[model samples]
Target chain A: MEPLTLDEKIRILTESARYDVSCSSSGSSRSNRKGGIGNAAASGICHSWSADGRCVSLLKILLTNHCIYDCAYCLNRRSNDIRRVALTPDEVAELTINFYRRNYIEGLFLSTGVVRTPDYTMELLIETVRKLREEHRFNGYIHLKLVPGADPLLVERAGRLVDRVSINLELPTRESLALLAPDKSREAILLPMRQVSGLITARRDEGRRAPPFVPAGQSTQVIIGASPESDLRIMTISEQLYQRMGLKRVYYSAYVPVTGDTRLPALNSLPLLLREHRLYQADWLLRFYGFTAYELLEADAPNLDPELDPKTGWALRHRQLFPVEVNRAEYEVLLRVPGIGVRSAKRIVRSRRVQRLRLEELARLGVVMKRARYFLTADGMTSGEADLSSERLKALLLPEKKKRSGPEQLSLFPTNDSDLSALTGEL
Target chain B: MAIWRYDGSFTGFLTLCAALLSQGEEPEEIISAEPLQNDLFRTIISVASDENRGEKMLAAIASRISPDSCRLLWQAFLSEAPGVELLLWRYLSFGRTTGVKCDRFLAHPAVGPVHRLANSVGQEAHRLMGIIRFQETAGGQWYALVEPAYQVLELIAPHFAARCSDMNWLIHDRRRSLAVAWNKQEWRLTRFDAQGVPPLSADEKAWSTIWRGYFAAIAIPERANLRLQQQHLPHRFRKYLTELEKPPRR
Candidate 1:
């Protein structure tokens, strides 16, 4: 075979890594050293947006696409006859520095397929990152994928060198992992996570002289709609990961069929993007809105409500809590309102301190009044015409919602109520 | 009622603000003098741009009101939104009495517009920090062109300066005719005209081609949502982004 050009190698590697779906360059605030090439902003910056509407934050690519394990849902599974290419450590470092100088990327997101052994692949990843950091003196954000079943010392070293680390628990349940990825196990994945979490916690109180151990902490991704797991089960696992593993984020990647495997479910339609979006909303609720997974979901209603967001669903189910006075409601209670988000909830609490909030004033403070109008009272006034019945309110919310054929398209200038909600994702 | 006007520079704006504060009288309007803004019913007072007074005004706001409020006032001035000067004057007057607590009063008519304008400038500066792409020039310097809606060239310069301190670079604001140049150590914002740009360095095209390929390959065809893409990276920005650029005709 003719040697693959750098362009061919980059295209192949990026395509293989695209399905992983964790592109955030935030959380780590690594400032540039005296002669370094880049820095990480705490808020993160999106260099470009892809056609799929995902933000292109980093140069997300793989070291190689050659795997020993055959994960049925993975594009780089061992059984697939795809083109396999791997860049050397120097190549990776040079590419990253050039891209950083050009301001084309925040940093590099380096993930890989297992080459020969987990430890060996981890060493390759570590060497590439070390070259970028030590050899090139690059001070940019790097999110390295912790190879499952890698040696503990290798994982520790990789965690120390990078800003963020993640190991994908591609499927939620052990049974699903066994069915789809027989080579991977629940224990092999959790060991490194537990190790990194301990290291991250231990390094917190250490002196500034100690090298930061994954300053952005760890995040993981789960394949939504891949297995038969329900939203309740997924959220419950996410909650556990947050509490137990001290994870920063748990991404939900909707399964798009990459292989004609007998184990994989064939979807004739689009990937479950709406489900993924709702899960992100539910995740935000858990992290920011102070909602429990069980509170957002019940045993009978295991999956999230397709029509309404998890917050709005929770608000509708608990209608007796409605019509909370905006002027006097606690910040936490204000967060529970259907249309109010963390920002608006804080705004409501702050602005009301200066002046009594009226029904119209709530909109000026960034409240999505279309949904909040049904649930909040401002200055002892309620929407006179809006019917408070749950059924009627649900109907009112449904009219502006277009029939779901695909992912919700957000309009920049949102003229209607549903468009506004889609724009803010407040609910 | 008095309508005061000054040159559109930040120093000029601050000089106008300083004059307004000393007068202890409310102006009906504050506006830029260039392009000659006229109001038929009000008297217009033209204030000269005094640099020392502008510096004094900034220091006073930083000490008396709050450094945070001072930053907000600067950002609002950068926004160059129509009639923002009046909003800032009201905010400054309110802050003078309210002290550091002026920003906390978010719902106040005097503070809200200034705060919102500052937020708009901040948001645009942050966005431009990402979307500003640099092409390698013939002398091995990185050059980027931007036409941001707000006067945000200075706001984003510190970021690129810190990140790319080892390299010489220039970021030209096409709309405002200003450029921020960094000479591997220090950076300065200077007046510039877009006569033309230097030729591309060798390998620049090759690297860009590879980048465009990666960008195209990274997007999933199944999840193609052009509208959502447009929402985040607006059409105006797409014109300058390398990855978003249309390849030259064969």
Candidate 2:
């Protein structure tokens, strides 16, 4: 067999990296220094979107596809019969710079399979970013994946050079981790995450004059549906990670079957994309909407409602919270309304200070009144539907099926229609 | 009724706005002179572009309204939307009379249209930041072409300048015949002419092919939704994107 060329290496490596879906390039403010090649935007930029509707923000690729352990769900597990290749540190650095020059990507997302040993792979990953930053003077957004159980010194060094770092807690529970990946331990993953979190806080405590250390902060990915954890358990774990470890994001990658192992879901099993989308919505509510995990889910109804959004479902479950007048509600109260997002809630609060808001003016303030109309009142008038049952309101809010003549006309505003659903991970 | 006309530049519009406010005249319409159309029963006042008047208008708005509102006015001017001149005129006049409190009144009749128009322009510029693709030319410079609905070259230039500071690149807005060129250190905006595709080096061609291949390989087969793809990356941006371009026939 012929050895893989640079092109083949990228094709295989990127194919493997595509499954771990943390493509955000924002939240870091790495500015361009004198003689440096690039800078990071505080609100990260997306360079492209793939056919799958996932964001292609970074040049996501792996250092190698060869692994020492066989994770049952991973495509690049050791037992899988697939082409294996690795790029040298210089090669990876050069590829990133060249791609950046052509504006194909914002920066590099360098994750690797366990090759030789965890420390060995960690050193190689660190070397690639170091060469890009110090040798080539490239200062773009670099998201380095931490090799579990690697030295904390190397992880700290990595934090200094790259804008963000992540370690994948692929499964929610330790029992699931033990069942699927015998080589990887729950402790191995959390130890590095804790270290990175502490380092980020320490650097932040030092005033603005101190250099940034992982300015974008640390994030981790958990595989949904591959393990048997319910949405309630998943959100609980995510909330804990956010509060305890100070994670920036907990990405939910709907488990796409890549191997035929008996321990894993059957190859014919569908990817739980809808479930993943619901989890992300709940996650957003947790992070921004001032909603707690228990508020969104309970032990009796552990799973998210597939037909309605998590917010709407929560509104239905708690009926007494509705009918909050838009004009009189506080900022937090307005945020709890079904239709109002964080932006619209802020806008509603701001606009009402000048004059009382009218129902007709809600759309101008960025409120998605389609869902909010049922939950709130404008001035003294109800949204024209008074004291409706929760079941009737839920029926109205559910997305209508097409009438079979033809698919409905696509919206001219890309952000309002299908693209927004994909971008926000909203169902 | 009086109709005011001026050069289509932002400064010219500001000057026209200043003249309207100082004269205590309420114009029926504020139109740019380049595409000037005659209005029956209205006196057309041709206002010259005055730098001092423009500066005064900007300063007054910044002092009275919030700096953020002033930015919104600037962005609205760049939108080139029909009747935006009149919209900004009304917004500024309203802001002047109402003081700093006017900025928060998003639903105000004079302010809402200008805010929406400015928001659309900002959204277009943000979209182009992601969809604008560059191809390496034989001369060692990276070139990209965009045809945004708004005059977004000024808005997007600073972003590319900071992100690709070391490399020389040119982003041409073919619809407006304008281009922004960044030469390692500083960037400048100049008029540009449309030309044929420039020749590419062998390595660039190979990398482009590999990129397209990676793009195709990564998409999940079960979740192929062209409607969603078109929604995120509209049809207008595909002409110059190398990965979206069809490969030449063998």
Candidate 3:
């Protein structure tokens, strides 16, 4: 067998990596030193956006597509007869630096299929990043994928060099992991996550002068709609990860079927994008809006409303919370309103302190009054003809179907008519 | 009513702002001398650019308003919005009277426009950080050309400087004819001539092709949303982006 060229290697590795959707390149502020080639911004920069609307924040690629374990849903599963290729540590480092120099990426997002052994793959990944940081003096943001069941010391060394490290919880539950990924165990994945989390906290507690261990913290991805897990279960796990594991983000990747396995859903099944999107919205609420999992979902109501956003759905379920006076309501109370996000709520709190705020004033403060009008009042005036009943309000608040255009057609290149809000996940 | 006209530079605008404040009379409008406009009834006053007065005015605003407010004022000036000068004057006057607290008054006639303008400029600068692509020139210097909706060259230069400290790079704002050049240490802004850009080397061209290939390959056809792509990266920013550029005819 001939050794694959660099282009062939990139094609195979990137093709394998495209399914993992944790493209965020934020949360670290690694500045460039005198001789270093790159730096990381506190607020991450998105170098580009793929046609899928996912951010192209980093040079996202895999170290190799060869695997020792076969995960049923993964593109690079061992059972699959796909062409396998691996780049040497030098190749990886050189590619990252060259790409960084050209401003083609913020940094490298290096994940891999388990090759030979978990520790071996982990060591290879560590060497690639280690070379970038030590040999090349590259101070750019690196999001390394910590191979499950790798050595703790290897995890520590990798954590120190990279800005972030993530281990994909591929499936939501242990049962699903056993069913879909016979080679991986629930404990194998969580152990490294726990270690990374513990190291990050210990480093923080040791003070700023202490050596950084994953300064951006750890994040994980869960494949949505792959296993038969409810949205409630997913959010509950996410909430736990946030509270107990100290994870920065829990990315939900909509499952795109790559195989015709008897156990998996058919290839034609919709990617559950709306569900993934709703989960992201709910995740945002949990992380930023002070909403708990219980507040968002109950045992009986397992999934988020497909038609309405999670916040608006939650607002409808608890109608008593509505009609909060924007002028007099507390900051927390204002944040609960369907239309008011974190920014708008803070704006309202600050702006109202200067003078009494009227309904018109809320619009200027970036509040989406179109949605907020039903739940908020200003200057003792309700948004005029408010529908207090939950059903009626839900009906009124639901986005009109006619307003939604047809399925977006893929363009070879960006068109002038491309909708910006749709692309940036502003939705 | 008097309309004050000054050179379009930020310093010139600040100088006029200080002059108007000293006179203790509000002007009907503040206009830049370039793209000069006329009003039949209003008296037009040509305010000479004064660096010291401008610095003093900026410092006074910084002292009264927050430093962040001064930054916002600068961003609004970069927005190049119609009647932005008048908006800044009104916002500065409000700031002088109310101090930094004036920022919270979102609904104030003067504050709203300035806030929106600054926000737009800031947003554009943030977007350009990702969309701007550099191609390697014959001399191995990285060169990227952009024509952002706002004057954000200064806003984005520091970011590139910090990220690409090892390489000499030049970012040209084609629309403004301004270029920011970083010489592996510090950066300086100068007038740019587009013709001076050297052609790409064969290796550079091949790397760009590979990059474009990667970009094309990574996009999931099942979830291709051109609308979303356009939203995150507008058409204006895509002109120089290698991935978005059309492939050369065979």
Q: Write the per-residue lDDT of candidate 3 for residues A1-427, one digit (tens) a residue.
A: 7887677778778888888787777788888888888888777777787787667878889988889888889889989988988889898898888777888888999999888888999999999998999999999889999998999999999998999999999999999999999999999999999998888878878998888889989899998777899999999999999999999899887788887778887643332777777898889899989999989999999999878888888888887766898888889889999878777888888888898999888888878887899888899887686756677778888876756556543232223322222233121
Position A363, candidate 3: lDDT: 84
lDDT of 2 by residue, A1-427 (tens): 8987777888888888888788878888788878888888777777776786666778888999899988998999999999888899999999888778777787889999988888899999999999999999998899999999999999998899999999999999999999999889999999999999999889978999998899988899999878789999999999999999999999987777787788877532232666777888899899999899999999999999878789889888888877899889888888888878877888888889888888888988878888888888888877678578877888898978646553222221335532221242111
Candidate 2, residue B31: the lDDT equals 81
Regarding DockQ, does 1 or 3 come out ahead?
Answer: 1
Clashing pairs in 1: none
Worst 10 residues of 1 chain A by lDDT: A418-427
What local lDDT score does residue A238 receive in model 2, on the 0 to 100 scale?
Answer: 98
lDDT for each of the candidates? 0.86, 0.83, 0.83
Candidate 2 interface CA RMSD, Å: 3.5
Task: Give the winner by lDDT: 1 or 2.
Answer: 1
Score chain A of each prediction against the true chain A by TM-score and list the results.
0.94, 0.94, 0.94
In angstroms, give how far residue A304 of model 1 lies from its true place: 0.7
Model 3 bad stretches (over 4 Å): A1-3, A267-271, A403-427, B34-42
lDDT of 1 by residue, B104-217 (tens): 778778987787788778878888888889999988988999899999988998999899999899999988899999998789999999666679999898888988999999
Stretches of candidate 1 exceeding 4 Å from the true structure: A268-271, A385-387, A403-427, B34-42
